[model samples]
Structures are given as structure tokens and as C-alpha cells.
Target: MSRMNRFLYSLADGLKGILRNLMMSLMSFSMLIGSLLVVGSLSLLVVNIDAIIQDLGDQNEIMVYVHEEYDDSEFNQISQAIMEAEHVVGFTFVSRETALEEMKNDLEEYASILEGMEQDNPLRDGFRIQVDDPANVEAVVTAMEGVDGIGNVEARTDVVESFLKTRNAVNLISIGLMVLLAGISTFIIMNTIKMSAYTRREEIAIMRMVGATKGTIRLSFVTEAMIICLCGSIVSFFAIMFLYQELIEKAFSSTGLLQAVPFQEVWGGVLLIFVGASLVIGVLGSLLSINKYLKV
Candidate 1:
């Protein structure tokens, strides 16, 4: 028989063996599905969080405040320095009138406060600069210090700092949860594989007596594992789509949050992660159980 034909026969035989032990196969497949679903959900959450952070970075803008007594030459020099920074995308100078007008529009409740300070307004002229990285806002602010006419710099520092810290914390939490879930899944899958192998002990012994090579014996178990995992991956893909549209998208949309979550862009990655995770768990479980049974 050709090598391809032999492989096909071996595959067919392996599948038949699994079908012959239908109960064990179903149990194994069920465990695989549960494990992969958890893995896929975590992966999708992480990916979407990362996308949200990217959008925030792209939209981040910094405001540099200039001192009251500083000369126009000093302001020009400070503006020129900021414009040269690599992280800076663009910069615009906000004149005193313009700043006052913006504040008047934004602070409707404080209209009297502005009217009282018409001539002696403490608000300073400033430059609004957009940067490539939200994380680099502090660095850009630091670079602007001591340049002529610079009184104090405020670029949503508190908001940006909080966001970075929160993003990192979320990532760490996601990783911890993923590791914990994976361990539980591995334990469950390993137990299931052991049970399946134990129940087929007699058949395995008979195959060995028939001069079956160790490779063939091991391949049979591994093939069953891969089939279970592949099926679970297919199922998890549909489950993720349902969850994304029905639960995730709806919840965020109701709150007017993450209006542009880029669901479709991240969908492919989520599927890839589920397939890869399922395959790893399945292969590991099968190998471990097969090794233990062979020793027995």
C-alpha cells in the first residue's frame, strides 16, 4: 500500500477505535469543549481590551500651559521645541481669547466665574499637541519643562496615568485567570484521557500481542485526542460569535461604551487562539495518559 493509503487506513482504524468506545469519546469531547470555551473567552477579552487601548492612544492630546509674563519669543521657542519631538503628531497654539471661548463653551455652570475675571483672567496661553503614544505623555511633558514661558504643564496627566496603570492591571489579571483556567482544563482532560485509556486496556493489550508497533499504539490515542480537540475548536468558534454579538456587544452598546470595539478585526485572532489552545491541551493530555498506560 502507498504511504498515503497506509496513513489513511491508520486514521480510519483510529477513528473506529474511538467510536467503539463511544461513551469515553463523548466524555473526552465534552471536556475539550468546556476547556476551549473558557480559553477562547479569555483570549477575546484580552484582544478587545488591547484594541481599546490602541484607540485611546491614537486620540490622546496634550495641553502645554505658558506663563503669564513670558514674551512672545519665549512662547515661540517653547512651541518650536514641542513641535520637534518625535512622539508629537501635531501642535496648535491656543490664544488667550480662544482658550477663554473654549472654557466658556465647556463650563456653562461657571459662566459667572469667567465674567468676573474678564480683564484679569488667570488662564494662560497654551499649545495643544497630539502624540503617537499615550504612555509617552509624561515624557513629552518632562521635555517641555524649563523652556521659556512655560509655567506648568497639564496634559490629562492623571487620566493618562490612571489608564496605563489600569491597562497593565487588566493584562496581569487576564494572564492569571488564563493560567488558572488552563490548569483546571488540563487536569480535567488528563483525567478523562486516563479513564479512556484504562477502559481500552484489554483492546490495547490485544493490539500489542498482534505485534502492533509502539508508534502505532501511541498514534491511535493521539489521533483520538486531536479529533476531540478539532471538534471543540469548531464549536467554540460559533459560541464566541454568539457571545460577542449577544452579550459583549449589547452590554457595551447599551452603556454607549466602546462604540467602536472592532469586533470583526479581532474575531480571526480569537478563533486562532482557541484552536491552538485546544490542540496543546489535547496533545498533552493524550501523551501523558498514553505514557502512563504503556508503563502499566
Candidate 2:
């Protein structure tokens, strides 16, 4: 046969193999869906945590207030101290004048109160500190308290600590769920592939005896495995879309602190990775499991 004819023959054989093992195909599809669903959900959870971290970096910060008696030039000492402090990513000096202006803008209703303080602006010069890591806010706060020119360090440790706990919990969940789903998928796929190989034993044997190379026979089974995985991955992608939409509506709509990353921004990458992982698992799993039958 010509090379093109040979390719067509192999392709036809692969399609026939998939349709003939309809029951096994369905079983494999179900297993893939279950596994991919858990994997995708955990991935989304990780993405949410990362988004929360970025938001925290922007919205939450530590304020290191300079002593009232400290001279403006003495701020260099505080800046130098902060530079040496661990976990400090960035800082900005807010002069008393700037602080007063901010207060006026934020407390417009109490503009008179702020204007009254203009004669004696009680607001001190301070450093707005940005911690590089939310998890290290406590450490950063502790260090800030010791800065030489600082009178007080104000960090919302409570909020940062809460997010820290959540991050750890989600990380643990992702690892545990991934392991569990992989095992379940492997178990189901192994069984289904064994049954598929068994039912097609005669066909496989005939192909082998009739000048068919082992690689050709193996290719057909692998193709079927890939087909099943692709279908499951597609289904799981849609399911994830629905789930994320529900989360946005029911969870994020009420809380601005937690915003959903738009699906359009991340779904393409997520889908690419999901399809790649599923294909690797499907093709490799079949190649390994179907080997005992082929002896090739």
C-alpha cells in the first residue's frame, strides 16, 4: 500500500476501534469528566487566591508614623531603617501637608474639622509601607515598630492573617484533590483500557499477523484514548465556565474585596493546559496499559 493509503487504513481502524468499544469509551469519558472537573475546580481556586494576593498588595498596607517631635530631615533615618527591614517591598513618605489634604478629601463632610486643625495639623509625617508578602505582614509590622524615628506602626494584621489562613487552606486542598483525582482517573482508565484490549484481542492479533507493525496497532488504541480525553476536557471546560459564573453572581457580586478574574482573560490558558494534561494522561496511560496485550 502507498504511504497515504496506509495512513487512511490506520485512521479507519482507529475509528472502528472506538465505536466497537462503545461501553468502554463511555466509561472512560465518565472517569475523565470526574477527574478533570476536580482538577479544573482546584485550578480556579488557585487563580482566585492569586488575585486576592494582588488585591491585598494594592489595598492593604502598613503605615509607620513618625514621632511628632522628629524633624523633617530626620525622615532619612526612618527611610534607611525601613530599607534594612525584612519583607518591606516599597514605601512612600506622606508629609503632614499631604496627609491633611487626604483627610480633607476623604472626610469632605468634616472638612471644617480638618480645616480647624490646619492651624495645628495633628496628622504626623509617616511612611506608607507596602509589605512584599501578605503572609509576612505580622513580621513586617513587628519590624516597623522598632524603626528609630517611628512613633507608631499601624498594620491591619487581622485582615492579612485571615487571608494567610485561606491561602494555606486552598493550597492544601489543591494538592490533596489533585492526588485523589489522578488516582481515581488512573484506576478507571486502567480497567477500561484492559477491557478494550481484551475485546479487540482477535483484531489486534490479526493485524499483527498480517504484516501490521506493533506501532500501528498501538497507535489506534492511543488515538481512541486521546479522543475520550479531548471530549471530557471540553465538557469540563464548559462546566467550569458555568461554575465560575455562578460564583461571580452569588459570591463576588456582594463582596468587592473578592472579585472574579474575568473568564475571557484566563480561560484560554487554562483550556490549553487542561487539554495538554488530559492528552498526556490519556495517551501515556493507554500506551502503558495496552502494552501487556500487544507484547510489542
Candidate 3:
């Protein structure tokens, strides 16, 4: 037979296998749909939470206070030294007078309480340093502390540490969950494919005896698995979309800051990953399932 004819026959056999075991095929695809949806949702949640943490980290700057008695020239030197510090993106110098004015505006109702303290404002001059990376904030703080004319470094180390810990915890949990789900999904898919291969064992044996190549039989089974996974991935995409819509409505109150990633922006990559992963699962499942039968 021609290669084209062989291809046609293999495609036909694959479709027949799917239809012959309709219930099993449906169950396999359904499992894929559910698992993929869960994975996609978790991925979006992790991305959104990370974004929120980063936004909060950006708002909180590293406060480096200079010596109160430092002259203009000395302060300039300190500021230049800080700018040269690693991870220091930029710095703003707030003088004692400016700090006093800000304090007054903040405590307008208690203006009388501050009236007697104006002659000896206790506010110190400080440089508000913007950190280039939140992960390096401690390093920036340590570097600032070593600068000459620097009196103190006021950093929310606890807050920064907590944020970093949250991000790391979330990341570790997400990775673990994804790995577990991938393994389970792959196991189920392999078993499902094995069932189909087992059903056709006698036919495969006869084909082998008739001189039909082992490659042809493997091709047919692999093709069947691919078709099942392709359909499953496509259905899973729409199911995920529907579930996400409901989730945004009920699970999320307002789509302001902690919103999940928009499906539109990520659907392309999601679909690519879903389909690619499904294909991998299907192909490997077929290979693993067909190994014993190949000897026939």
C-alpha cells in the first residue's frame, strides 16, 4: 500500500478506537478538562497575588536619615554616596523644616500642641531612598548604614521580610500543587489510553502475524490518544473561561487590585500550555501503554 493509503487507514483506525470505547474516551477527556481548569485558575491567582505584593513593596521606600548637624555640603556628599550604593535607585532629601511643615499639615487639628515646639523642631533631615529591587532592600539598608554623615537607617525590615516570605510561600505552594496535579493527570491519562490499547490487543496481534509493522499499530494508538487529548484541551479552554467568569463574579467582589489575570491577555499562553501538555501526556501515555503489547 502507498504511504498515503496507510496514513488514511491509520487515521480511520484511530477514530474507530475512540468510538469503540466511547465511555472511556469521554471519562478521560472529562478528567483532562477538570484538571486543566484547576491548573489554569491557580496559575492566574498566583500571578495576581505576586503583582499585588510587588505593588505594595514599591510604595514603601528605604528611609535613610542623615546627621542632624550636617551642613549643605556634607549632606550633598552623603546623598551622592547613597546614590552610589547598590540597589539605591534614587533618593529624596527632606529637610527638618520640610518635615515640620509635613507634620503640621498632617496634624492640623492639633496645631496648638505643636506651637510651642516650633522653636526647637526635633525632626531630623532624611533621604527617602527608592530601592531598585525589593529583594535587595536589606542590602541597600546595610550599604546606607555604612555611608559617612548617616545617622540612622529606618527600614521596615519586618514588613519587607513578611512580604518576601509570603511570595516565597505562595510560589512554593503553587509549584508543588502544579507538579502534583500534572503527575495525577498524566497517570490517569496513561491508564485510560492503556484501556483502549488492551481492548485492541487481539486485533493488534493478528495484524502483527499478518506482517503489519509494529510501527503502524503504535501509530494508530498514538493518533487515537492525540485526538482524544486535542478535543479535551479545546473543551477545557471554554470550560475554564466559564468557570473563571463565575469566579470573578462570586469569588471576587471587586476587580480593582487583587483581580486575577484577565483571560484575554493570558488565554493564548494558557491554551498553548494546555494543548502542549496534553499532547505530551497523550504521547507518553500511549508509548508507556503500548510497550508490553509491542512484543505481540
Worst 10 residues of 2 by lDDT: 249-258
Weakest 10 consecutive residues of candidate 1 by summed lDDT: 1-10
- lDDT score, candidate 2, position 117: 81
Residue 54, model 2: Cα distance from true site in angstroms: 0.7
Clashes of each: 0, 0, 0
Give the poorly placed runs of model 1, Cα more than 4 Å off: 17-24, 84-86, 104-122, 292-296
Winner by TM-score between candidate 2 and candidate 1: 2
Using all chains and alpha carbons, the TM-scores for the candidates as numbered come to: 0.83, 0.85, 0.83
Order of candidate numbers by TM-score, starting with the best: 2, 1, 3
- By lDDT, the best candidate is 3
- How big is the positional error of residue 86 in model 3, measured in Å on the Cα after superposition? 0.9
lDDT of 2 at 193: 66
Residue pair clashes in candidate 1: none
In angstroms, the error of model 2 at 224 is 1.0
